[model samples]
Target: MRVALGDFLELNLRVRSADDARLQTIFGFWPAFLVAFALRLVGLFKFPFLDEEDRMMRVAVNGLFGYGPQSGQAPFWENLLFRTPLSNSQAITPLWWWTEYVARLVVKDETLSARLPALLTGLIGLALFYWLARQLFPFPIPALLAWLLAVHDVFLWVGTKAQYVESFIFALSVLIAWALLVAQGKWRPFVVAVLASTTAMGFFLLKGMTLTFNALAVGVAQTALLRGGGRRLNFETIVQRAIFAGLIVTPLAVWLLAAQAYITAHYQVRVAELGYFRGIADILYALTFGYGTGRTASLV
Candidate 1:
């Protein structure tokens, strides 16, 4: 009877402890989020021309308005895949470009629209970072880390600018957090692997090559380190890890193929219009043609 009573009491205490921790996490997140939002909000509207926001806004504008003489000739898929903004090499990530274009469509303000994605990802990253920290550390540490990240100048700068850094970091945070959870066995490995791989791929579409390699490295390193600590990784776990590594690489390969096809089609259109042979002959023709016509002879 005494043993039964002690066991019941211990269980009750643990339940209450978990409830308190849950409440603390809930409370910590809102305050940190609000404060971070307030800090980042001003930068969104105030310094709109910082970094590559100008260049990205131009790309987004071209994405909405179409690019080059072949702009109208492009199929829906061509427009969807190629956002190089009048050239083949200047392509921003398709997802980010679309985000900017859609926001511009609704908001009708170029700078604000371009910066919105970064601001949103910044907030989302804060939430993910806080959750990950809470899972890995004690109460005050998670809360403190959340506040610190929220106030960090670099995070603040990138989070409010119109560029890929904030989104890339946000994607990286998601990958690392998911990896850690899988390592801790808090979730089913297969489900987590699929979801994390998909998330990595999706973000790779948004930010391109950087996220792919980072996701692969994080998966291998986190799983290996955790598995090294006396717990033998099963065959299924190995297969899941392999699946994740493969999935992450798969997106990059597919994207490169699509990008190459789009660029080739786009340049073909440019060449037919500009009357050049092939392989950057258009660029050479432009320089020489200008000089031959005496348009650029004054500079010489």
Candidate 2:
């Protein structure tokens, strides 16, 4: 979200000559992104919905369009606090459903309404990926990498799909990592510290388990900073870092505790649901054979 146009241009200026930057912008970034956008547009209109997408759209319709009690018109307080729609499993998130719902409300075209979020977020993620690459790599390498990812068939496919708004979470993860690692100011770290905490909660709202992994990765990175470069940590510095860690973790902790209560209440309701393993045997099979089958399909 902090990827300002000025900052992007400034970073490019720092790394390359103005003419080179202009050439890369003209011949590298814009062309690649435009091609990528066009390809995803093709998929959005031409490709048939897959089974997973059909299921996701079904859930979205049930929540957003269904009448009677199935309608998504919850009280604002309940909508804010309850985890009724946000699942622990890998189904579409409530946020995604609401996004499509709002799109439908605005546009009245089911296909466009359903698929627009993926296309938009996918474009955002692609842009962020390019920016992050520029930060790490020099000159044309970043542009080349962006071009490759733009034409990647899998990425294009996912970009156009309705159920694959993982792009949103991916963009958020990229932004969070970029902010925490590349920030250069006194108050900026503190601001990022607080925003990172809220972002974890936002991740939880978007997808289960991603919040935990993202928080752990950021925590480990910060911990590395504490012990990095042979700098001895004084007691006061240690205390300040501890407080900083606390500030970054408290929001996520509160959300997780609240979510646990809701999950416990709903435990009985999830029995034998699709994608819910029944026993240790099912889990073991999934860990070994099930995922391999997907890889095999990909290779095919």
Candidate 3:
């Protein structure tokens, strides 16, 4: 088959296109993507207020309410709760808080403000997932992955109208995934450092360290590849990692200190008798065995 190179290239592209079309057909691809995004917006104004969504709203508008009267209550009970020396705490990630904070300024309802960012971010995640899949995998397969995720029941429910912290968490996750995929290629270590650092900072601001911890794990993997067993990491690479780590933690540390101080000044004294580690364990149990965002005594 003495075919011309041009013809071979054209044939390869056509085969790829056909494969993508077939996968989309089997998966209900575009209809599902469009429908999923639309469905997320359906009854946007009518979706009622959920429980913890209000507490997060408080974190934004009311400042840190750690060690308040919510003790023996639900926010600490239902979801994975982080404790930092407080009897009753409400120190959620600043990202969603501030987001809902600003959203409150515009949309004057509890449910809409809290869920607005979630809805927007979830849709962004959907589009970005497709791009990320293309970056991480070859055609048709990437297309398939995006379409499957579009209609995924649990993920779609959480990311879209659930209005949980998982919304923006999911959004930032896609950004982090994109950054990770690009970092695998020609991006300089410093570029990856910036991408990762900023993403982790924003992620920390929105949620607690759970996803931040995942980001750290990914950074470690990338560092291993960057080292490539060729030689020990140089001083500059060390510095890059150092700066990256600093960018990730410093904001959180400052936020915690200031938030803690402010809460102590404004609210009743926070008691640490309940134990911070205990709170972490309780939350772990709730997430693992209990509902994704509600309190349960599954292990406690």
Candidate 4:
């Protein structure tokens, strides 16, 4: 009897499989994607123009054509000196300039050109949120959390508008945290930490006061990790750890220094203006339950 060729091929291809695990992962993502898509669609019609949205639009417009609110010379000495350093200084990341330019090339209309980047950035933010959540938690929980975030009205609202750096900062912070957690004292994690920190620092430059909160959060997380059961620190150990931390954080430190230099040379503006209030009620409202213009509903 001759062995069939197909039989041998099938035997060779057969291996230990996690088909069930794969299926669960695929199914898990469906509900979250659907909910996020629906929320974003609804937001397009419900709130087309928000205050920060206008600011983002202005920034994009100024960035693209080198025109708009920052166009004319101002009377305030600080505005005259600090803001005028760059002809169209709008306190935006240089990355936005490239994004704005691409938008202008694609769409001739100023309003559409301005709003396009925010829409794109919002989508990126949502995707990053899901990616980060998945890295932190097991299957359904992360997916479920992502779904909750997806339909969140305020996030959806902010996603549609421009000038809000929280979404971007939040996403970068998540990536940095994930990289730090998974890093085995490797170069890749160090590189990622540096890049993520630099990007987050852009938000700080755009609005200076994020520095304190960001610094505190990073410090607490690092201290917790260092102290948490795995490692012991002596004088030599402490010095080594300090050196490692410094290497990881140097990029952010440099960016902060540059931003501070810029601010100091030109303005007497209070850094406190960079901080904003989001009351406990607002946090509870946004995270635990969703709030609309006039009503609130449970996220679950």
Residue-level lDDT tens digits of model 1 in 1-300: 999999999999989879867876777767878989998899887865843555446553554566634356556465656544323222233555556667777876767777887898888888878877777787568878888888898888888877544454464556555665635454454445445445544443323334445655766786688678876767786677667657655765576566556557655433212233323333344434453344551111
Q: How far does residue 251 in candidate 1 sit from its true spot (Å)?
A: 5.3
Q: Judged by lDDT against the true structure, how good is candidate 4?
A: 0.52
Positional deviation of residue 126's Cα in model 1 after best superposition, in angstroms = 0.5
Residue pairs with colliding backbones in model 3 are 67-88, 77-295, 78-294, 78-295, 94-205, 95-205, 95-206
Residue runs of model 2 more than 4 Å from their true location after superposition = 1-16, 67-93, 184-228, 232-267, 271-300
RMSD to native for every prediction? 8.8, 8.1, 7.5, 9.4
lDDT of 3 by residue, 1-300 (tens): 557888999999989877776665456445657876776776455555565444434432433333344433335322122222133222233444456556777887756665677778777777777766665665567667776777777666666453355555566667666666565433364454455445544444324345555666886787788679665666775676667657656765676565555444544333222223333334334333653334332222
Q: TM-score: which is higher, 1 or 4?
A: 1
Estimated TM-score for each candidate: 0.68, 0.68, 0.64, 0.59
Clashes of each: 0, 0, 7, 0
Q: Which residue pairs clash in candidate 2?
A: none
Better of 1 and 4 by lDDT: 1
Write model 4 residue lDDT over 1-300, tens digit each, in one string: 247887776666552224433543477556666666666556544555655555545553553354675444444333323333222332433444445556777888756665555655566666776666666665557667766777777877666555444566666666666665655345566556656766654443433224334644765577678779687545574467558767766765664455456555544322211222122223223323434464443222
